[model samples]
Target: MEAWLDGLPADSVGLRNRGLAYGDGLFETIAVHNGRAVLLERHLQRLAVGCQRLALGHDATLILTEVTRYAAAMGEGVLKLMLVRGDSQRGYAADPGRPAMRILQASPPAAYPVVHAEHGIKMFPCATRLAEQPMLAGLKHLNRLEQVLARAEWQDSTFAEGLMLDTAGRLVEGVFSNLFLVRDGRLLTPDLSRSGVAGVMRSELLAQAERAGIPVWIGDLRLDDLAQADEVFVCNSVYGVWPVQAFAALNWPAGPVTRKLQAIARSLLDA
Candidate 1:
């Protein structure tokens, strides 16, 4: 079977595509609602940072224009924008002159269980831990073997997500979402200095919390901290916000802070 790249038809991707040969690229999954892409600028900003760090040449303005057009046409769906280093020769070194290719796609947003957002969801601690790489710390690069392995640690629907720690046993993030904790009336999230993707929704929530007078802190968190937290939540662009009803045997009520954040997220995301 063949598919289209953006709007043009393409039978098959080139065999030497750098994204396939090596995960040499970046991708952004954006949520669309009422024919609009949510947090589009933030997504582009992250992609730009990734390009800069990875030394991949990309036209940010062009990508933004393409995404805007696609989002408006799709009306409501998930937009995945993948920027690859184009084709490369059979070697580890990349050609500096190769033009980047943008694979734009749109699909229906996932229909998550209502209980997950309302009553909250359960999480299990995964055995797989993320390795520290300061150079790749907060970029959502195409290389996601760590997340892939962590996600494969479980297969049941009982746990909506799995919590992954760093090599030093400090809490980092979920398999696919950014983790946050509310403790002693303060909002806390793991610092992504050494690992983890700095999610767009996470940044939005932090800004919203600040404007709303919520005490927010970003630092290294421990399992004991989660146990002592007054409330816990996880967020991503697609799912918005999901309260953590329980982790292992320790359970927490969805406190005011989490509910407030959820309300804010709904206003911005649910449309």
Candidate 2:
């Protein structure tokens, strides 16, 4: 894997970079297929929203241009873009006028077990819970210690992902993906207003569902909801969608809705 810092080949960032120092930044993991960035606009839109919410100064046009060029060069792979507040003095205070730093890394596409998407996966009941921070809820901020800890909870092939809940015990999302439930032909996903990431794939799925005449609901979700769901699945921009068959004592089959949405996700990622 190689990285580009500010559109130049680089292996390291400045010692005082705010992103390295305080995890002060946002990132996007994009998929590139046949020299094209998948969901490029949606990814950039989310990054723009994060920049606005964080008061980070960034040039959206420059980012788009560079990301496009990089993705073209990457062909079929994963492109990770990190935008940070640049270097600063050794303190919590940051210069508002400082230019942001852009770090881009390209790696080969992720490989997961075929059984995960075929027979479905068993989810680990993670004890790590997400903290409710409305200000930073939906943004893909650089601070990801919570997810780091949650992911570390499992280290076996038996579980494909971990189920994460918010501090208030509300069903939030997967360790690195968004959660969704299909109930009575309705699509239900957790609201990220107070916790979890508003994943690009999740947003896309909701829009696709609505356009396809599937009733979509976004709000608080509970374990009882998952238990009663007719189908369960988790999704990310990279891996698309994986049907979750088991979480703790509860189990579900990959039903018609899961298959339908999985196909939709497959088409999007493959496109």
Candidate 3:
């Protein structure tokens, strides 16, 4: 098993460590399968992009290398890398010269009960709306209080996830995963341009769609739209893809298209 860090130091005061003062940081939850990181390059790319956007020092390569070392020793599990502006003093104004400080960790695999894959999951609409922030949209930033509160709507194990809507009442994504729906033989997904995390699995599925000649529509969706969907599924890097068996009164089957995508996702994990 890989070792861990309890927290950062006390003397960690720099006018640049905005993460401690204002949660000015980004993070990624990566799946380490069979001693390999699924979509390693893509995750690194996204981390780098996030650092650039936050105006943090461009040194994601160093962090990626550190994560790779821990993943190599941690065996099969999950890896999380939190990159934040280094110890910045008591304000939001970021110091351009402060280097980014990163916290890297590896944890025991989240036991994704296999039953969810076979029987599917029950999800509920949450009262908390996903805030619209174009600058932070699609980036896995630390300001995830919305997800934290939305997920608190229930503690039922049977309901594996929560479906959250954006401020505009448009279907955004699950509390922790990207969502896709099939209707009239067409596949549709909420565009992350306005909100939601652009999950690694979502990107993989889109690539697979192109390779399979499947056309996907990225658009705004509402509750009635999902109710009319022929099938529904949620995906993340680790969970792969899970077809929604039921959400509220709506029911969906493990549609043929979803099955195919799941197969591909499994293959990636297996590889």
Candidate 4:
């Protein structure tokens, strides 16, 4: 039995589409606002970069046209665009001339557990470690078994997210959102050079913090650093900023810094 592809169109693309065959692709989940995507350009730029890495071509204007059309049809919702290496015969060797296939889906944004947000999140020290793939780091690629496993680490709804570290035991990010720690009045986030997806809201928050006169340090972080952290928050484009209230007994407040960044994040959402 073919499982349903949720939120995707019923009109099927070929089953042999190389992307389905090989997972040779990338995707971006963008929030459409007021009939326009909040950060459509950035998402497409990331998609183009992903295509460039695989030697597949992407026409920015063409994709933009489709995105505009899709958003127009979907109205205000999350639009996910998947770009994949085009159909090809079964082989490990990629054909240099292969084009790309685009698949689009739209859905209402997953309503965040705002009640948990109000009380703040309960986190798990996830056992799953994200593999450090330098070539694939910072790209939202389709190969996400690591995330899938980490997400399965805790089924308890009390925990809003899970903290995933690298193989070296360095705190990298959460299961889905980018992490931030406040220490000694400075903001610190993990460097995505070795691993983790460079999130859109993560980049925006970093820049916004700088503009707000907050200094940021991006480097490897140990569990101890996070444990001793005065404030901690996780962010994604749709959720804005959610403070980590407790991580397996380490209690934290939605402090002044978290609230300040929350205000900044809300402004971007309202924009």
Best by TM-score: 2
**Residue 249 in candidate 2 has what lDDT?**
90
C-alpha RMSD for every candidate? 1.6, 0.8, 2.8, 3.2
Span of ten consecutive residues with least summed lDDT in model 2: 1-10
Candidate 3 lDDT, 1-271, residue by residue in tens? 5333323323334554566568888888989977777788878878777777777775656666767776777779888877777665565677788776777677888888897887788898789998888888899988889999998899878889999998899999999889999888778999888888998889889889778877789989999998889889999998899999999888999998888888888888768
lDDT of each: 0.90, 0.93, 0.82, 0.81
Q: Please give the TM-score that candidate 4 achieves against the real structure.
A: 0.93
Pairs of residues clashing in candidate 2: none
User: Could you tally the backbone clashes for each prediction?
Assistant: 0, 0, 9, 0
lDDT of 2 by residue, 1-271 (tens): 5799998999999898899889999999999999999999999999999999999999999999999999998999999999999998889998988778999999998998889888899999999999999999999999999999999988988998999999899999999899999999999999999989999999999999999999999999999898789999999999888999998899999998889889999999898
Off by over 4 Å in 4: 1-10
Question: Model 3 — TM-score against the truth?
Answer: 0.92
TM-scores for all candidates: the values are 0.96, 0.98, 0.92, 0.93
> How high is the lDDT of residue 46 in model 1?
94
lDDT of 2: 0.93
168 Cα displacement, candidate 1 (Å): 0.5
Best-matching candidate per lDDT: 2
Ranking by lDDT: 2, 1, 3, 4
